[model samples]
Target chain A: MTAWQTKLTETFGDACKFETFRDNIRCDVRTERFLEVMKNLRAQGFDLLLDVTGIDYLHYPKAADRYGVVYSLVNTESGERAYIKVRLNDPDPAVPSVYSIWKGCDWMERETYDMFGIVFEGHPDLRRILMPEEFTSFPLRKDYPLRGRGERHNFPTVLRSDG
Target chain B: MPLAPAAQYPIDADETPDHEYLYTLNFGPQHPATHTTLRLILTLDGETIVKAVPDIGYLHSGFEKLGEDLDYNQYVTIVDRMNYISPICNEIAWHHSVEKLMGLELTPRCKYIRTIIAELARISDHLLCVGAAALDLGGITAFLYAFNMREKIYNIFERMAGQRFHPSYTRVGGLMFDVDDGWVSLIRTFIKDEFPKAHTDVARLLNRNKIFIDRTKGVGVLTKEEAINRSASGPVARASGVVRDVRKEEPYLAYKDLDFQVICGTGGDCASRYLVRMGEMNESAKIISQAVENIPSGPINIDVEDKLTVPDKSSTYRSIEGLIQHFELFMWNRRWKPPVNECYGATEAPNGELGFYLVSDGDGKAYRAKTRPPSFIHFSLFPHLIEGHAIGDVPAVLGSLNIIAAELDR
Candidate 1:
């Protein structure tokens, strides 16, 4: 096992399921223990939080949960990347925020909440980041239509050359 | 070193005991310094900003959603608009991620050509950032000098990929087409003769100018810890002395073989960021020249029978198998399919680490396409940097970050 895998398994024991595919290492942790794993990773030199994005596995039949939050972490010194994932069930599709660990997660978590509707518990300010404040739909959800629900048309056309 | 005249005097200290002393100022949604629709709600005490809340999302076009609807190849056109200043870099980054997911190995010629194009894009991008930052601080001559060099680079792009700005030049398997000797010579001339002169001219005009130095020296300084904690990348993090460049570390495309230096700045200020960008332009020139000189003479794309490689027009017209392959590649129902897996691929974009997180479901189209835009993270640091500094320093810092609005709001 690589140092990252060792570090993960040593920290979380059997709670961490480490897997490598095509040179990318991903560790699966439950939502309850996700924050603890992230804190450990940060302490273990995963200084850069590259990205925090959530995936909706509504169509995957084998998935145990409907939502999966992916945290792409990078150890800048070693140029090694680690991805930590936590699955959230539909009943409570929320996970603890990592804003305290990495300040970069502030907007990233909000964006995830805005798109996937997966709440980041304890996020300082969680709001719709890429959409309007009044917009009620999570446009990135699997059920959401690509053309949108006529909400885009409701806005006024402000610019027209003919006018 | 001294404060601006307005900041030297205090505002209403005790005049309004019942009222809020700090007045709010909406910096943008259409401000010149922002260059795009980025609104910062600032609570100002006279000239110094006490708090800044960046209100973004005006330019969000739901491109990520569109990625799910479009096929692997069809989404390249959409990715071009993410970072308009360096659209080719975005194209390369998107395809690099897609190629990684599909396990596509590019030809050596394609790799070298890609490195050259990407470096040219970087030079143009940094030139624009430095020039515009200088212009934002009342240096128009530097802007013109920088733009003139950028125009030469545009000519090279026009020669290679028919379009100057949105050159959807990169296809899934390889480039749309290959460049000839004329394009190579033009790029060589730009690197050898034109770009350096313009770079020097711009540097001479603003590098030691007292006004420029004073305005930018210590303005919006981000400590190394803050830069790393906030996940700042590219020149922004480098200026803060946090060593991380995807090109140097990740070694994508032809960067592993090419020789170049990673410029760093210790100041962590606007001036430091500016110097880092300027030094990077020089290094980019060096990399481009090296790649151009060592470009291998071979097929630009893989000579494969896969659906990812579009069949040549003559082959499609002459051979029945080519016709069938072409139809199968472009047909609505039957196209290239990806495995049910997810992959994250990133490149050292001019701004920072522009990453693409793709989730495929064994479909022709992506199930989930998430863009990890560096500008989004860089822009998040705006509120932190703008606070406790004079409002005038906003442009200097914003320019240093080079937060492309399209990428930030994508």
Candidate 2:
């Protein structure tokens, strides 16, 4: 293992599970400390923010605590890629925004906010991105209703009429 | 006193308030340049954009919510709909994520086939990007030329998968169907003869034209640091000198075996981004040629312990195993459950690094499937990119970003 991986494992210990697949190192960090770990990783040269996304786990009790926020980071020069998984529980799922550290997080954070409703604390403009402003629910959430909002405007008939 | 400057007006004068006077322009939801039904409410100051707030969700079909209710195998088709321009990458990324969690090793032949098809999709995506960009730049002639080539690529796709768009040809274990000899030759011919000429023609028509250059050269200048900071991927970042091609960096699906360059440009402006995508298309054509010429002879799919293969209709009557396999593979909740873990897989999508983050709670259905679409992120930077530019430059900047609204609004 490289120095950064070793440092991550030592710092988080049981809270952080480490897996090396292909050429990438994946660290599962506690959601509360996700921002801190990312900051540390950034300091250690994972400068590029490749992607940020949310994963729902309503199916299992183990993951039922909260949604998962996965951040993929890479160092442009070294070509080192790392996947950090942060678990956020349902009631107050919030993580500090890395937008301050990496500007790239601006959009990715908005997307996470849009899909899972996991608010990134300190995001400059946190708004519903993919969905409309009046959209009442987070569409990506497992428990969200898939069909029939009962509003006339929500009906496919309205769309057909417009077409 | 001589007529005081207009600024000396009383606070309660009968004049419109600054906020009310500002024009609220809706750019999309039905507008053609949006690429999809993405709606943006741009508050404009004269012709300059004051604030461009994107009002998306017009095309939100509850794909993620639907994924939760559907089984694993059934979700691949939904992924295809996320980025309609290049559905192959979506299928490949989802399949790869599932395969990773399941610890399934794809056959070498399957991997090669994936590379070929993915490159084809990349070429097709670049065709749309180039054609659409040209159209937005007011080069209707070049746009038509690029679309003409795009039509040929679409015809190839139709012949192979029986659908021009949303083929969903890639399956969990392997391809839904193998490439026949006819399809192989057609693709080979496209890569060798037709593809290069299209690139050349497009370049001749639009690349160095004074008007095209003037409109795009310095517009939407995102620096390398800014591009990376904004999580820009694919050509957007590459055009900014980020050199962050997921294929070259991560080496998923035989990209490691193939020799190709990660096309990069110094200028992070519209012109540089356009050129980078054009260069990438050339590279994609080269990759297709390599794959076609050196493709190995073997079964496209692996035989797993469970009946994971989709059975043919002809064998359903004669073979019980075929019938059972077909039922198991296609039936709801019968898809394989990957171990309880999370995996993130990214592909060098035409737009950018299209990623799929899947969380499996040891269930037949995905616990959570989040898509990291490049278009969404790229479009988010629009407010910053178009701030000082004129309304006329909006189309040029948007075209350069190649923001596919299907991916953005997904």
Candidate 3:
């Protein structure tokens, strides 16, 4: 185990499940302790928040959780990467925001909220970032069809002559 | 570094009496500074920018959603569209992720070829960014000089992959085709002669020019601590003296064998970014030259006996076994046997660290594919950089960040 992994597993016990794939040290944490775990990670030197994304595991073969929020963090000093994921259930999934730790998660959290309908509670601005304000459905969900649900056709067309 | 703010933003700390008079200026869906798509809501105190709200997603095409529908090989075409300036970077990064998920060890020859092409893509991307930044600041001669070499790069890629614009030349385990002696000479000719002349011309035109210096020297400064805290990478973060390059940090695709230095600058301004990119281009040329000379003479794709990749055209036409292998791989059922696991692989793309987070379910397509595009993260870092700068410095900062719209919103 890496230094942080040993520290976390000892303290949190069953809450932090460690898995290594390739070189990334992945730790899957339960949703409730996600924020606390992230805070600890921040203190442990995983300072660079490389990415924040969401995944819907509705029809997956091995998954027990319905939704997952992934945090791809990097320790700039050590050149190490850590992938921390938290399991959240289906209906209006919400997790505590990590904006307090890494200021970079502002857009990433908004994007997760935009694409998967997962909410980051206490996010300064949690509005839709990619899709239009009036657009309702979350597009990245597994149940959401590939061609979309006619939302593409709903926009009012404008001609160049109007200029 | 004189203008580097002590905090992330000092807009509230220096609350002057005229803070109430700050006016909002909508800076583009049409502004010349914002390329074609990026829009920023600049809350300006006369000319000084108090706060800049970058409005992206003007070119969102639901690429991650599209990744679900297309198979691993088929998604390269779409992936290339993300960072159009360095489309090959996207191709390599996507396939790198796929290769990692499958736990496939590429041949040494394939690794050398990928490194060469990847370095070429880096040069091409940096050239465009530098040239376009000059153009944005009205140095037409330097833009022409940079584009001249970029055309040579396009010709070389065209010769390599038979496509100029979006060469989807990368497969999961290998490249679309092998680089012949002629293609090798084209690159050798490029780095040794063509690239240097153009680079020198651009450097001479912009390096010590007073106008260029005045516009970019101290504008849009990102301090080292702020850059690291905000997860900035590539030339942007390196310019702030962060000294983190993914190629050096985590070596992949033959970078471990290559000799190249991570270029950095302490200024963290637009001018510093331009200089860092210039230094990186020279390093990229060094990488390509070395790899071209040492490219192992072997198969570019995985061995046909492994049934991991498609057979070559001549073999497929003549050999009966090749026909069956082709049919088994593409025509009938797909031959991908991936583990049901998740993997995140990243490349030191020219713009920054372009990474792909892939989750596999033993299916031909990915269950979820999330892209950590450099443009996305860097654009998020935009408001932080542009907070205390003037309205005129928007293009300088934005162009230095090199925010490819498709990549930003993907």
Name the candidate that leads on DockQ: 3
Docking class of 1: medium
Off by over 4 Å in 1: A156-163, B1-19
Over B1-410, each residue of candidate 1 has an lDDT whose tens digit, in order, gives 96689966566667656337778998889999978788899899899899899988999999999998898888999999999998999999999998888888999999999999999999999999999999999999999888888888889999998998889999887988889999989988898899888989988998899999999999889999999999898899999998888898889899999888889999999999999999999999999989999999998877757667777788889999889888887887777787778889999999988989988887777888999998999999988887899988898888888888899898
Candidate 3 residues lying further than 4 Å off, grouped into runs, are A155-163, B1-20, B331-333
What DockQ values do the models have?
0.74, 0.58, 0.79
How much TM-score does chain B earn in each model? 0.95, 0.92, 0.93
**CAPRI level of candidate 3:** medium
Error of 2 at B354 (Å): 1.1
Q: Mind sharing the TM-score for model 1?
A: 0.95
How does residue B344 of candidate 3 score in lDDT?
97
Write candidate 1's Cα lDDT for A34-109 as tens digits. Answer: 8888888888899999899888898764666789889999998898999888888776688999889999899999
TM-score of 2: 0.90
RMSD of each: 4.3, 4.2, 5.9
Per-residue CA lDDT of model 2 for B1-410, tens digit only, reads 79988878665535767776568888977886656677778888888888887666677676767676677667888888887877888889888877776777788889998898889888878878888888877778887887888788888888888988878787777887777889889997888889899889988887779999998989989988888777788898889998777787678888888898889999999999989988998898888888888888887777744465566577766788777777776665565656776677777788987777776777778777777788888887888788877787888888888877667766
Q: Is candidate 2 or candidate 3 better by DockQ?
A: 3
